[model samples]
Every structure is written in structure tokens, then in C-alpha cells.
Target: MPPTPSPSPGAPGRPPPERRTDDPSAVPSSAVGREFAFEKRHFDFIVGLIHQLAGIALAPHKLEMVYARLARRLRELRIKDFDAYCALLESERGAEEVGFLVNALTTNLTAFFRESHHFDHLAEEVLPELRARHADVPRPRLRLWSAGCSSGQEPYTLAMVLASSIPDLRRWDARILATDIDTHMVETARRGLYPAEAATGIPPALRERFTRRVRENGDTRTAMDDQLKRLITVKPLNLLEPWPMKGPFDAIFCRNVLIYFDRPGRTQVIEKFSRLLSHGGFLYLGHSESLYGVSSSFRQVGPTIYRRV
Candidate 1:
């Protein structure tokens, strides 16, 4: 009351020595607030960790892209910072979180009969040769693996090729094992419903054989027919995880999946694919990818195809 005690120096009337909250730059070195601000060090650590855990390399320039995808998880968890979220990833609950990260970061760019040349080669050269080779073997069986098959296109393409080219597909034990790291993609592939645009490049004959049209509320819709759908089995597969399908496959289509992996990661995956292939089996990579520097286990058979050597 005596002039409010003259508002004593550094007292209630005055600001409290520019406290951390009021001036972030003035925060004590030990205060966690200073560390909460985004730092390049933390960014690099996250990028490296993602590469290690998922074989998906998030380049330095993609720091914003990573933040855009993962920030939602941070918010959903009520986490105000990345450090705490990263630490949480080290725990058992982190497994699910890591799965989300992997799914988000992976590039699932794929379509029916992508790299059309591969399908042509399969129909004309590979399948014919396989049939001729197995003609003498009773109950001819063929196994093809579409590793990193996103939303069923590659495997569905494989099925279409097999169904069209194979003379006695009904009698043959032919199957395609389609897999991807993303569970959502796997489930979508299993549904076998594709937009009409997806069938644009599909040859008319193949489309007729593999797809059926239905009237959906006054609109015509096309979907993969039962026969083709029956030929492929979609499953969730993480290339970073242990191989679940026992193989000796006639061919393995792993197109476009390795571009995200570093040299060592790519090499490890190639080696595993080589082991899965039957002797003389073919391995097809994406047009932009190669096994040349990555592995010596496979010999180049075509621009994007390899033979287990």
C-alpha cells in the first residue's frame, strides 16, 4: 500500500530475470526446453535410424518430408518434441510406431504391368521356356514371387501373363506370392479391385480374360475376375524382416523396391532373393535399379532381369 512497496528491484513488479519461458535463448543450458527446438543433429539421427530400421533412406533434403509424415504421430501421442518420441520408439510399443514409420516412408509407386517389357518377356520367353523345361516333370508347378508388390499390380500382371500364355493353366499348379512391407497395400491388393484407368495399358484380350465388368449403381465397374484373383496370394512382408515364404521360385519380381535402400542394405536383400530363386530362376528388378554393384550372386539376363548364377 506504501506506493505498492515502490515495486522493489527484481521483485513481483519486474519480469523474472527473462526466465526460460519468456526468452527461449535465455533458457539455462540444462533446461530441456532449449533441446526441444528442431536441430539438424536430431534430424540426421532420425533419418539414419529410419534407414537402419526400414532400409528406406530419407535423404538430407527430405527432412521436411519426414517431418510432414511423422509429425502427426507425435501430435497424436501428445508429444511436444521429437526427442521424446524417438526415445519411445526404443521400447516394445515402439514396434508398432516403427511399423507406421516404415509404411509412411516407403514409396509404393506401382501399377499393373509396370515395366511392360518384363511381362512381355515373361509371356513370350520365360514362361515358354519354363513350360518346355518342366514338360517332362509330372504335375508341372510354377512359383513366382512378386516381392514389394504394391497394391497387387505386379502379381496381377504376372497372373494375367500366366493365364494367357499357359496352355493348360487350369491343370497346372501355378501360384504367385505377392508381398509388400505395407499392410494397407497388401490388403488392397487382396481385394483385387482396380480403377478403369489402371487397365489402360492392358491388352484387350488379357483384360477380357482377367477382368469382369459389373454395373454398380448405373455405372460400369471392372474388377479382377475370380480366376486371376485365385492365382495370387497377398501377404505383408518387410524386406528388413526374415523371409517367410520358402522358395526355389521360378522367378522373383522385386521391381522398384530397392531404390530406397543403401548399398549394404541392397546387397543383403539381393543375396536373400538369390537364395530364394531356384537354380536358373530369374530375378526381375525395376528399370531404374540394378544388381551389378550390389551382388555377384546373379548374372544379368536382360536390362532389368537377372538369373541366379
Candidate 2:
């Protein structure tokens, strides 16, 4: 079934949200003969806090997803049910759990070169122009931001593409700043290790150029070659908060990150991104999102690609 958009918190919703699924992994419910206490009221409080904290709107249908994800937290903290979880979130003591909660509930689906066309455009069009424009300067500066760089794929891809496409990559002042709201993701990205399977999506030539295999205890892992790794800086950044780094970013890949935000929040982020761009710099969005009715600062240049006007 298609995922439907439900009303926001404080609006009318189903009476306690009845759900049916045969998936054995589902949590114990407050329903008949079940132990789960995730009633409508509990869900509203949790989701409302998510909105307030991260500007992500949780649809009513996400009750199961929320419960499944956060149920582990309850187990880890030895809390019994959703009611207690909600209380802890509201209390002064809840500050730390808030981070854990956001980490748990946030969705991160990413892969290297997941949207191949964006990298193609960068290699074929964007980098060449930036290189020519900066050639006359003594210290050429290039900045790229992977604003929601989950698990490092996007930034690592950017690094690889830049290394291959730019003629004098090392001489230029070039860096890819990859940031994510989830602390764990930032750490994982820093490690630059991936299971062998993750390499399949990456093109063979780029993979051969930029990655190497490492073996530890019979596990063969693919690691980003240091040449590629040196060009990236990974750190935690909450997009809703003020960004610390000054930027005239040559390109920014903020794909799939804005869908979680409400309209006003998305608009604010788009404007901020525009300000960060170098004149005529590129912004890459997820395929499903668009700038229509959101902002006029950018004009579409390709599928899911936009350039600052």
C-alpha cells in the first residue's frame, strides 16, 4: 500500500491507530493481550518532539516504525513502555535521550554514487568549469558539502570524482566537508570502512582508482584510499542549527535530506544553501524533491540538479 500523509500533531487522527501486519518483528502492543503501550497520545508526544527538535514531521502511519526503532532504547535503558519513554523525553533529564531518539528514528538510506547522474554532471560539467575559473589564482579554493552525508558514501564519491576529474587536484585548496546529524553516522564515515558488498554500486574504474581492500580476521573490507580520504573532513552537523564553517561551496549535495523537514524548514535550508554557494554553484536534491513553490534562487539544470541563479 502507498504511504499516505496523515494529519500533523494536534489535528484529528484515527482512534488510537489500528494496525495489522504479520511481520513477527513488531513490538508488543497495548492492544488485546499485548504489552506494547504505544497509544495515540504517546505517539503524538514523541512525534511532536521530533518535529520540534529536528523539524521532521512523523506521519501517524510511522507509529510502527517509531515503535520498532525506539523499542531498543527502552530495552537498553530498562524502561518499560512508551508512556515512560514519553515522560523521560519531556523531563529535564531527557536531554541526552533526545539525541538517541533522533538517531534511532531518523532514516538513513544511502549508497556510493546512489544517484549516478549527479556524479556524472560533476565530473563532466561542474568540476571542469570550476578548475578553469580558479586556474589564475595562486591558491585555488574549492569546497563541497555533503550536508546529510550518511555513512560517507556521497562525500567519498565526491572525493574520488574530484581526484579523477581535476588535473591539479593536490595543488588546489580542495576539501569535501561531510556532515550528518547522527553522531554514529559521522563516526562511521570517519572510519572509511565498508563491507565488501557496498562496492558493487561504485563504477569499476573509480573503485580501482580510489579504494583498496583490507583484511582483518578473515573479513575483507574495502577502505577508501588515503588519497581520497585526505580530501574529506567528516563531522556532525544538525542542519536546523547554525553552521559553524564559512562557505562559498563550489557544490553541495544535500540529497534526500530535506524530505523529513516541513515546508518552512525546507525553505529556510534552501535559502541558507543558496547563500553558501559560489556564484553558479550547483545544488543536488533527491529525485523526489523539487524547488517549485519553495524558492526562486535556483533554476533547474538537469534531473534533480539545480544551479544558483
Write candidate 1's Cα lDDT for 141-167 as tens digits: 899999999888788889988988987
In terms of lDDT, the best-performing candidate is 2
For candidate 1, the TM-score is 0.81
Model 2 clash number: 3
Off by over 4 Å in 1: 1-39, 72-84, 213-221
Give a tens-digit lDDT track for model 2, residues 134-180.
78888899999999999999999999889989878878999999999
Per-model RMSD to reference:
13.2, 6.3
